[model samples]
Target: MSTSDDDYYSDGIDIRDLPKVSLHDHLDGGLRPQTIIELGEQIGLDLPATEAEDLADWFVDSCSAGNLPDYLKTFDLSIAVMQSEQGLRRVAREFVEDLVDDGVVYGEIRWAPEQHLQGGLSLDQTVVAVQAGIDEAIDDAVRDGRDIRIGQLVTAMRHADRGLEIAELAVRHRDRGVVGFDIAGAEAGFPPSRQRAAFDYLASEYFPVTVHAGEADGLDSIRGALFDGRALRLGHGVRIAEDITIERSDDENVYVSLGRLAQWVKDREIVLELSPSSNLQTGAIERWGDEMDDHPFDLLYQLGFRVTVNVDNRTMSATTLTRELGLLGDAFGYDLRDLESFQLNAAASAFLPLEEREELSERISAGFEAADNEGA
Candidate 1:
């Protein structure tokens, strides 16, 4: 998504200049259009739009329509270019580069390997190619004096039957750049309970998972994500807002109550990876209102829930973690401390090991401290 104008226009400190953690970014959803054209030509896949600008605008317009099916169809084009090893590597590398340029300190890139096997590559081969690109980009960013870290959240499609295999893939590659596992795609009909085998396998392997829940469905889907999938974090679990009730009250105070599910999520510190733009575009928060102010991110945070901002799809949502944070700041009057809290939440919710997560938190705190000290 766009990060150029994400400066702290109202917050007094430029949000883009702060270090951020991206927990819910998607690899397939963040492809560069020019790269798509180049890669598409090799595979003989005809693009809907030949020019990069048209393609970019097309993505923006398609996603802006606020329909989940239409939003997902854009991936058909991105996935078309990512079927081969070379295409996967190029896309992954650019994805990392784009994150570095956007000032992301850490990110977890999630995508299903099954979608890339149309080119005769095995699932393992796809992981290898994507990891190679991530490594190359990491080394390049280090050479450029930019410190950034990324981990793969190897994902399986919820409607697909590859959950167990993909969970095994993620665990197998855990030490080799894969950090976690996830299930995505059509959350309405496919609940996490359907992937019981995968979650069981992942739990047995001590693997981390973050399931896409509460986006296309409601509380039952979220319950399935937590109870069945054992998700360490909720992918756009913004719909947990539905579980909260606002009771009428007099001038003294407004009575608010949380359903059992919402209470459990809040008490357990389950991180809600809320993507404001994507939430609006996909109608995740349409029940609240049509604007960013309608988002329950503020409510969740106000209620002491572990809510972290995210850019669900960099291309489709056209957002960065910084932009998401900036928008939240604009909507809720949040400052640097609030932004830092979201980063801390993401750092904690990361699929990385505890030690690595602690280090990430330290880095984030230090970065924010330096920014504040310098500004002062």
Candidate 2:
């Protein structure tokens, strides 16, 4: 069955109302269909569909190409409209609003600014524009009685040589809305090592880094993200499960052994931003199977990896954090407690100060308790 933006529940609890943290959400991939239609018209760019509903359908259908290259092609249309400051601002504002509706109390929106300079906007100008939109949306949400916080993760494309420039841009705006740095894009040939200079600069600045590894690549890519990029987190590190071997299994339990790489990741508790539907759509989990149940998310989580659920691209996957959690719960028979654990994992992994992370944990605990009490 197709996933929709409708409400999702497990055991009479509405998942949408639960407080959550989003760590791997993409700024360009979550554009509203109606906004895309209007923006395309203004830019005179030919879109796959003109109507909002039709456009939304087209994105989902087109993105289900079962490979990273094909899945990334959908971004061309979205990035085309996001070339101008106005376009970036509108999309960022709407992205925050949508997150508020999805019960996200905190989120980090990641995007590559170098790709959005087609309309003559500078790299810093694009960042400022997106920040303006985020600030405006936060204020608007506050006026409407919703309190949400957001941070920007300025990403550098792995296939480009602009990593150092993008890294500088992110650090320049560190005091602004930008929170951290990331390297995303085609991961196979373009390893994080390609951007070693940027990573070194970021490391020297004591900045946080999350690399897009183990999604389209395997163990070596993940290793580079950690050792070379010094990535604190692995974006969609689902393929890390490849390093784990199930030595034996019985009716009641399963025995497993982890390779050195997986062992270090698990022992260090590096966050794995696991996006289930996106993984399935991009064939990231095709080594296991073609279904969501085949995802290594459960394996990583069960083995004590710092696995946090995310909606990598809401529009492309037609999903939300709530829907992703709901799907995982259904596939793996998760209950409220299991769901709460995911939120806690995300809260702890968020790129925030120690005190702030603790506060987030408290809020999540209280929210889950309230939900439990209400259900009782």
Candidate 3:
């Protein structure tokens, strides 16, 4: 194993050199520490730590509070600086650059535009600002000999009552840069059913939707996401493991029984955006255990569920998509084949058109093939 500043290696192969697709990454959760400092300074918002490194550490520490609500507290600082169009554009631009360093060929960055209205920017303006940043970063990365493609997943806060409005905002910008709709924040008390109007509207328009479910709640929430929201994908559906029953056979083989909910998800091939480290930190997998090895990711993958690795919050987890893959490899004894399969799963699950998704799969296959040949 080898570790560098921006890459991790197993068997002398740098994981960062492999093509990756990021589906569950959040814009507010992946900020650079220095960007937060400069933006916070301009806005006169007091931050937990002034130094970049310290602030980074603070995010990690604060997020390690063992619950979803506490983990979400770290976002307040990031969102504070992102109210202005300039701030939003800069952060979104740097976000793409960071993804480039992590070797992400395609990514979907999700953020709630309603939160950024404090700077007097309308919902459409916020989307435009973020799209501007994403475009600039793509051009810059291409100029520098890196290829990346990104789309926005316009998110609505589930705890709030503006789901229909946010859904409209996302649909309105679908042609501009938005690719999908999502409902994030406080998944316990507020279910996707609360956003039925939005989901209904989105369904009428045939817009893709992914809901944040099974992280703070359990199987019922997953049910709500599927039935009410008609989610094409699940954000951190780690807790869907709750619906499965496991038993050991006499031959020591594990026999698994899936409840109807889990069966539906598996049969339909619903994508589970499984963030291993973030799930552990937020106690999303506490029912299983308190460590990485205890995560249900391996079980889900072994059972042939559509499990894709993610860094749900990069700064809070102090990680990148590459690092997340390395950690999963470490915990689950995965090799290049397993890692490649995860990327292919993500590529297939991306909210792009069928043609675009096929192109992404081709890119991933070629990239992994080249990496394997180089290592050999």
Candidate 4:
């Protein structure tokens, strides 16, 4: 689709030029298909698709299967390449490069170290490799005159019993490169309550957290995310829309009531890291509809939720943060101010210290203000 004012979009600014902050991105989910193929070849792992372009197409097709397990199957190939220290470093480096290309000034890349241990790397070693890559990329970006900051969100598989371990790992690396902790996997059966030990430990240490909740499940899962996980943010918590009861509507406005869970998430300003393309592909918003237009993003924004846009998985969803914002602007007729609001939401929700978050917010506001003046 033309991102310019041609047929597809006329958001009054180059979406690519507008600075963005990505809070729910996944490290494994953002690998280039060609990189996967090359790394797999190095390790003698044959791929389902031989050609890089074909492999890219395969991933989009695979993730569109609309269930977490099916979506997760696409990761086998990417994770296969990411088994070694070299592989992890290369992918992490490229991840930041891609984010910079997408105009992201800040991003939190989440991935599971527990899964990468199949290749014999200890969790600490894998983190070291990933951090080396992040620092290398940061230096490269500085050389290129683009400043970006990225931190890791260490994740534990919900089906496993290593939440407490992963939580400790996250805290251990807090000053090194780690920013937060998360639980990712089957949500329906594996509730956050099951990881109470991890959550309690993280809470005691005052570690920030964001859980994948209310996407595959409903209100109870969301509650667990907040109370058990003590989530400072939510990963694709689109299904929280379920708690919003629309009682009546007129031509001008719609009347709705927010359930307590929904109310708390909204009032607390808990960031909703909503990925439009990924949510549709993963069926996270199937209760609403199968298409982007059917998404509750507009409703949530209208109802005062802290909805921040993200490209959860760049390769899997065949999207960039710019493309995601462009599609949303096209769909909702949002102007630069609206887009800035999303960025501000992400900046405010970052795992950074309060002073740094305020600085980021100021920088963002300055950029948008400059853009506004140019338009004027």
Candidate 5:
């Protein structure tokens, strides 16, 4: 099921044509390489590569460092070129356009606006500029007969102390395309408790939240995301696998046990934003193994945890939602039903209202059914 020439197919079906929902896509990490080269030049920033293909290759090679901190270093270049309003708008617009190219019907584009404010734009202005790009892209998509919807998930850096301010910023723009709040960056030392005030404020405002946990850190971080941050979903919560213990294995069955934390997450159906390629790149799944087959995604799915596949960084991982699904299919022998379940999980977990979420689920079902019929 490996992708060829940036396209993916599985079981006689074009994976790229299947309607998908992307919940954990990072806007800063999904920029076009040519755009980065152009914007970097405009800002007098020295890029490692001038050509788009070489720059794209550089990102993949640089981010494949097998550790989170090392992998994150590649973002400095992408974020640097995104300081101005024009840069942000272009990146955001193309971000949605690329989602449509990947057959994503709905996506939540998450990025830290504070990082993009250095080019003389205020926090609100940054959101507005990005939203402007998104709006333009959505309009273009509609005119081209492609239907897509996007939402902004405003993010605060975990190592920074602007949590409350970012939370307020997100709430202020809730009616202007922003749909949720999140905290990302180094997840080890800075737990969600560090942003308690922000979480408290967001909760008071009834804003949706998703915390980056269980990727660079472990269960305590996830507990903080759940209990302290009141996160509606977990970003790359793949490390929750640590809480499960394999008791033993027999000929036909493998006995296992789940800790209270894992049990609670499963019982409550907390969505795990599992990014197959990024998890491997960031060493989030190193505990299991270094390969996609080692990913706990199949295990989590088998255990009935609400799991959704994602492309955490399209540029860094050189992946799309289609490619991630194809890799999972290669690793776990997933069928069309398995893939549809992942989309359905993401649709339900989207920060959209319940009615909109239901409508999204209907779209996914219809799209997959059409693909199924074509294959049959």
Candidate 6:
């Protein structure tokens, strides 16, 4: 049940081969170290580490800080190298390729286009370059006999004042590659209500939204994301566990109750895009515990919350979907069925059309069924 460099298996099934849907992956956070070095050199950008392995180590080390702000500081390097059209294109193409290797059949890569415009590229231009890269990667995967699909989730930094602009940009490119809109970045002081204009616009346009809440803040922030931003999914909504109270404990059963917010989230089936390693790295679950076993993911799952596993930042966490699932299995003694349920939850929560989502669910079920048969 432990994941090593060579193996990521759970319940006698190779986790690497299981189909996954990545709902909270970040574009600027998942770059390959070598790609950063090469892109940094071309852009005359000074890097913390010139060597790939050393750079990778630096990212992991810098992001291990048990606070959300400190953990996010490592992104300056990754985002610095992603300013130009070429950098954006290459990073995006490789992002999808890496997802394929991690067994992600469907991934919604989220990034702030406003941050990538420092190189004089317009918001639309940056989106176009990224979509071009995604198209190329999908074609390459098809040629290699691997069926993979990707969608872009355009994000607006919550601290910034460009929410309306970013929301418009996402909708503008909806036909190209953008499938949804999101608000990320520092989620403590800036609630989704601050960007009411943007959310209202997205709502008018009937666009899907996922907001970063319950990670760096508490229930109030999540309430704003739900009511103000009208978010359909919550990014790292791990802190919602704060609203759950354990009433009593017995040898046989532990009685618990959910607050109004938690009850609403559970009743509405709002997808919680839970990133296990990222939650730990950012201190999102510190109130519960400091280790993986302390994560509220199991509590939420057992309570019928629609929970899904994700690698928020592949480079920063030095993790893959396979590795995240393995860690959860190790922590919770989960079997193949538990892992399959996570995938099904994610597939059902994807931003695609209902028909496409159903197709994705079928693909995931078929893949897990094959693995189960092999294990049997």
317-347 in candidate 6: lDDT tens per residue? 9999989999999899999999999999999
Query: Model 1, 305-324: lDDT tens per residue?
Result: 99988899988876777778
lDDT for model 6, please.
0.94
- Tens digits of per-residue lDDT for model 5 on 1-376? 6557576677789999999999999999999999999999988999999999999999999998888999889999999988988999999999999999999999999999999878899999999999999999999999999999999999999999999999999999999999999999998999999999999999999999999999999999999999999998999999999999999998977778999999999999999999999998988999999998999999999999999999999999988999999989988999899999999999999999999999999999999999999999
After superposition, candidate 6 runs with Cα above 4 Å error: none
Q: Which one wins on lDDT?
A: 5
For all predictions, the C-alpha RMSD in Å is 1.9, 1.5, 1.2, 1.7, 0.9, 0.9
Tens-place lDDT digits, model 3, residues 64-181: 9899999998899999999999999999999999999999999999999999999999999999999999999999998999999999999999989999999999999999999999
TM-score per prediction, in order, is 0.96, 0.98, 0.98, 0.97, 0.99, 0.99
Give the Cα error of residue 322 in candidate 2, in Å: 0.7
Ranking by lDDT: 5, 6, 3, 2, 4, 1
Clash counts for the predictions, in order:
2, 0, 0, 0, 0, 0
- For candidate 6, what is the TM-score? 0.99
* Regions of candidate 5 where Cα sits further than 4 Å from its true position: 3-5
**Local accuracy by lDDT, each model:** 0.89, 0.93, 0.94, 0.89, 0.95, 0.94
Q: Which ten residues in a row have the lowest lDDT in candidate 2?
A: 1-10
List the candidate 4 regions with Cα displacement exceeding 4 Å. 1-10
lDDT, candidate 1, equals: 0.89
Q: What lDDT score goes with residue 77 in model 5?
A: 98
What is residue 329's positional error in candidate 2, in angstroms? 0.6
